[model samples]
Target: MPLRPSRDVFITCAVTGAGDTTSRSDKVPVTPHEIADAAVEAARAGAAIAHIHVRDPKTGRPSRDLELYREVVEKIRASGVDVVLNLTAGAGGDLVLGSPEAPLPPDPAGTDMAGAGERLAHVAALLPEICTLDCGTMNFGEGDYVMTNTPAMLKAMAARIRELGVRPEIEIFDTGHLVLAKWLKDQGLIADPVMVQLCMGIPWGAPDDLGSLLAMTANLPDDWTFSAFSIGRNQLPYAGLALAAGGNIRVGLEDNIWLKKGVLASNGDLVERAVAIAEAMGSRVMTPGEVREKLKLERRW
Candidate 1:
C-alpha cells in the first residue's frame, strides 16, 4: 500500500514578498501594523509559517530599512500569534541590467547590490528561525535583467548565516540553481538536510509543468527536504504536487493575489485554501508547535 502523511503537514503563508507588486493590488500590507496583522490572520487560517518581506510604507516599495524590519518582527512576536518567522535576505539584490548599447554601467534605477553581511543585517538581529537564500541568478520574467547570486557571494552569505545559527531555505528557480545549492552543501557552507524551495513558472525561468517540476525534484539528494510552488493560478495545484513528492506547501498573497479568477484574496484566504487542499489529501494541517518540532525550529522570542 502507498504511504500517506499520517501527521499534519505544515503550511507557510508568504505574507508579503519583496516584489514591487503593491501597485497591482491594494491588499498587500505596507506598514508594520498591517504586515503583522496579515501574518496573524494567516496563522489563524492554518499557516504554521509566515514568510515576510517588509516595504517602505510611504512608497510601497521594497526596503532594507532594518528599523522597518525590526518593527515588523517585534510586532509579530508580541502579537501572540503563534507562527514560524521566515525573513527574506533577498531585499537588496534587485539587479536591473543596463542597455546593451552601454553595458559597462548598470542602469542607475536597476542595480542595487549590497555586501552579504549588509544584505543579512536584518536577519542577524531579528534572528528568525528561517531565512531565504536565493540559490542562483536567473532571468526573472521577460525583464531585461537577471537575478544574480554568484557562487562566491552565496558562499560568503551562507557562511554568515551559519554563523548566526539561522537556517537558510534555498530558493531554487531552476534546475541549475539546485546544483549550486548542493555544491554549497558539499562545501560545508550550508548545513545538512538543506531545505529547498522549487519556484516555477515565472516567465524566463523554469516553467510550471510536470516534467520541469519532476526534473528539479529528482535533482535533490535523498537527505534534502524540498518544496515546490507555481505562481498565480498554479499555486494550489503545486501544493498538491509538493505533498505527493513528500514536500511541504507555501501560499499567500506574495505569489498569488486572487482566490479565484476575479476575486481578491487576503492572506488568510490563501492559507485556508491550502489547508483545505492538504486536508482533502488526508494530510493534517500542522500548527505552529507541530512545525517547530518538524523543522527543529526555535520560536521567535
Candidate 2:
C-alpha cells in the first residue's frame, strides 16, 4: 500500500547552525537572545522543531557553552513557543591533522577536540526532545582539517543520551555511517524506534545525489523515523524530496542563507516557505505535539 499521507508534516528549523555562514550573512543570529528569537520566530512561522547549535556571543562562531544553550532553552520556554528543542550534541571534537609527515599531535591551527562527557554536557542539562550524534568520522574536506568522531566516541555519547532520556537523531553522512548506526542498534547502545537524519551533499562526506540518498535509506531499519537535508543552494529543494521519499525535512540558515540569489532570509521566512512547499504538494506539516506522538517522544517531564 502507498504510504498514506498525514494531514500535516513536521518541520525542523535548524536555528543558527554552527557554520561559518555568519561571515557571509549578517542576518545569522549571534547572541543567545538573537538565536532564541530566531527559534521563536521559526516556531511562529510553523516549524514544529528547532534544531539548534550555540555560538560565542562575541564571535558568532560555534561554542559548546552550556550557559549559552541554557539561555536559549529558557527563553524559548518563557515565550511559550510549542517548538521542540533539538539541541546539538555534535560539538566539542574537531581534529585537524598536520602534514602526512607529522600526524601525532595534529595541526594546532585546525584541531578542536573535547572530552566525550564534556562534548555532550549541554544535552545532559537541557534534555531536549532531540539531539544530533554524528555516527562516523571522516576527512572533512580538502583543507588540512577533519571532523573526527570515532566509534568509541559515538558509543560514549549515545550511551549518555540514552541515560538522560534524550532522543539521539543519528546523523549519517554516508553509507558507512548507516552501517555503524545499525550496528549500534544491534549492540543495544540505542533504543528501538530509532531515529536518524540522512545528511546529504556534505563536502568530503556524502554526495547529495539520489543514489547516495537511497543507499542510506535502504540501510535504515525497516521501522525508523528519518529526516534529510542538504547544504547551501539545495536546502529547500531537498525538503520536498525528503518528504516525497517518506521522510521529514530540515531547513534554516544553518544550511543555507539566501531565499534566492542576492536575497538573505530570516529563519521565519525559510520556514514559512517550507510550509507552503509541503502543503502545496498535498502533504501536511505536522505540529510539535504531533511529532511527539509520531516519534513516541516523552515531553518535558
Candidate 3:
C-alpha cells in the first residue's frame, strides 16, 4: 500500500506511563494531582487525548490503586479541560521470573500479575472514552520481565470495556500482535472501527525501522483507524511519519523524556512539539471534539 498523507490528525499524549522513570527525571508526574495537572497542560497545549497511568505517590513506582486513578480522573474532569481520556488497561500484566536456574517462582518485587477483572477495575469505575487492550504478550525489556496478556484475558477485558461503552485502543507491538487484534475483531469481541496503536522500538518488540512500520501498516484492515509511535528520539520523527501514513500520532513523557537532547520534557512540551511537526507537514491538529466525532467515542461521564 502507498503512504497516504492525512490532512487532519489527532494527537494522544501518554501523560505518565507505568514505567520507573520518576528518578531519571523529576518531570515524570507521580502523584495523582501532578498527573492530572500534566494531562490538563497537554490538553491546553493541543492534545486531543490524554492517555493516563497513575503511580505510587511515595515511591514513584507504577501503581494499580483504584483510588489514585479516581483522584486523577476527578481532577482532570474538574479542571474544565476538554481532553478525551484514554486510561491504561495494560498494567497488572508484568511478570518477572526468577533466575534461569530457579524460574519456577516469580520475583515478587518485579511481578505484578492480576486477573482481567482486577486490571479493569479502574476502567470500569471511571469509564474513560478509551482504554488500551494490549493485543499480545511479549518480553517487555532487558530483565526476565514478560508483559503477559493471554487470549482469554484480552477477550474478557474487551467485552468489559464494550459493556462500559468505552473504546479499546488495540495496542500492537509487532506484526503478530496486529494479526491477533484482527482476529479479535473478527471474532466480534472488539467493537467496529477498531482503533489501534502501533507501538514501535520497545526493546525486543518491533524495531523502529521504515520497513517494519510499513509492513505493520500494510497488514492493518483498511477500515481501521490507527495511530503509530516510537520511543525516545524517534518519537518526533514518527509523528510526521504516522501522519504521512494516514494515521494519528502519540507523544508524551511516557514514550520519550527529551524534548531535545539534554532537555527533559513534560507532557505539554511533547504535545506542543508533536503539534508543530504535524502542522508543519500540512496536517491540521484535531481538537478533542473532532477526535471524538472521528472515533465515534462515547464519553460516559
Candidate 4:
C-alpha cells in the first residue's frame, strides 16, 4: 500500500501495562495515585488519550481489582485533565500451561482465566470512553503462557462494551486477529466508527518490520480509525511509522522503558518524544476534545 500518512494524528499514552517491567525500570507506576499522576502528566505533555492498566500497590504486579481501577479513575478525573480514558479489558485471560510433556493441567500461579462478566467488570463499572478488546488469542512472549481470548468471550465482551456506550479499541497482534474483529462486526457485536490498535513486534506474533506493519494496516477496513505501536526500542520509531501509515500513535513506559539508549523514560517523556515526531512529520497532534469528537466517545466523570 502507498504511504497515505495521517495529517491529523492523536497519541495514546499507555501508562502502565500488565508486564513485568517494574524490575527493570523504576519509572513504572505501581500505586493508583502514581499511575493517575503519570497519566495526567502524559496528557499535559500532549497525549490525547491515556491507555491505563492498574497494578498491585504492594507487589507491583498487574491487578484487576475493582477498587484499584476505581481509585485510578477517580484520581485522573479529579486531576481535571482533559484526556480520553482507555482502560484495558484484556486481563483475566492468561493461560499458562505446564511442560510440553504435561500440558493438560495449566499452571495455577501463572494462569488467570475468567468469564466475560468478570473480565469486563472494571470497564462496565467505570464506563471509560474507550476500552480495549483484544481480538485473538496468541502465545505472548517467551513463556508457556498464552493470552487466551476465545471467540465467545470476545463476542460477549464486545456486546457488553457496545451496550455500555464505551467504544472498544480492537487490539490486533497479528493479521488473523483482524479476521476475528471483522467477525465480531459481522455478528453485530461491534458498532460503527470502529477503532483498532495494531500491536506489533511480539514473539510468536507479528514482527515489527515495515512490510509487516503495512500488511496489517492494509487489511484494515477503510472506515475504521486505527493506531499502531511496537514494543521496546521500536516503540518510539513506530510513532513516525504509524503516522506514515495513516494511523495514530501510542507510546509510554508500558510499551517501552527507555527514552534513549541508557535512559529510563517516564510516561511524560515518551509522550513528549511522540509529539515531537508527529510534529516533525508535519502532522498535527490532536487534542482530547478533537479525538472525542472524531471517535464519538461518551465521557462520564
The candidate maximizing lDDT is 4
Task: Score each candidate by Cα lDDT.
Answer: 0.84, 0.85, 0.91, 0.94
Please state every model's RMSD to the true fold in angstroms.
Answer: 1.8, 1.8, 0.9, 0.7
Better of 1 and 2 by lDDT: 2
* Overall local distance difference test of candidate 3: 0.91
- Tens digit of per-residue lDDT, candidate 4, span 269-291: 99999999999999999999999
Q: Model 2 off-target regions past 4 Å? A: 1-8
How high is the lDDT of residue 200 in model 4?
94
Window of ten residues with lowest summed lDDT in model 3 = 292-301
lDDT of 1 by residue, 1-301 (tens): 1333434578888887867668887898988889989999999999988999888899887788999989988998998879889898886677787767766577767677898999999999889999999988887756567688899889999999989888899998888888899899989989865778888888778998988887777777877777778888889888898887777899988899888999889999888889888988988887889777766777758
Clash number for each model = 0, 6, 0, 0
Q: After the best TM-score superposition of candidate 3, give how far the Cα of residue 234 lies from its true spot, in angstroms.
A: 0.9
Query: Alpha-carbon error at 271 in model 2, in Å?
Result: 0.8
The segments of candidate 3 whose C-alpha lies over 4 angstroms from its true place after superposition are: none
**Model 4 spans > 4 angstroms off:** none
Model 2: per-residue Cα lDDT at residue 220: 72
Off by over 4 Å in 1: 1-7
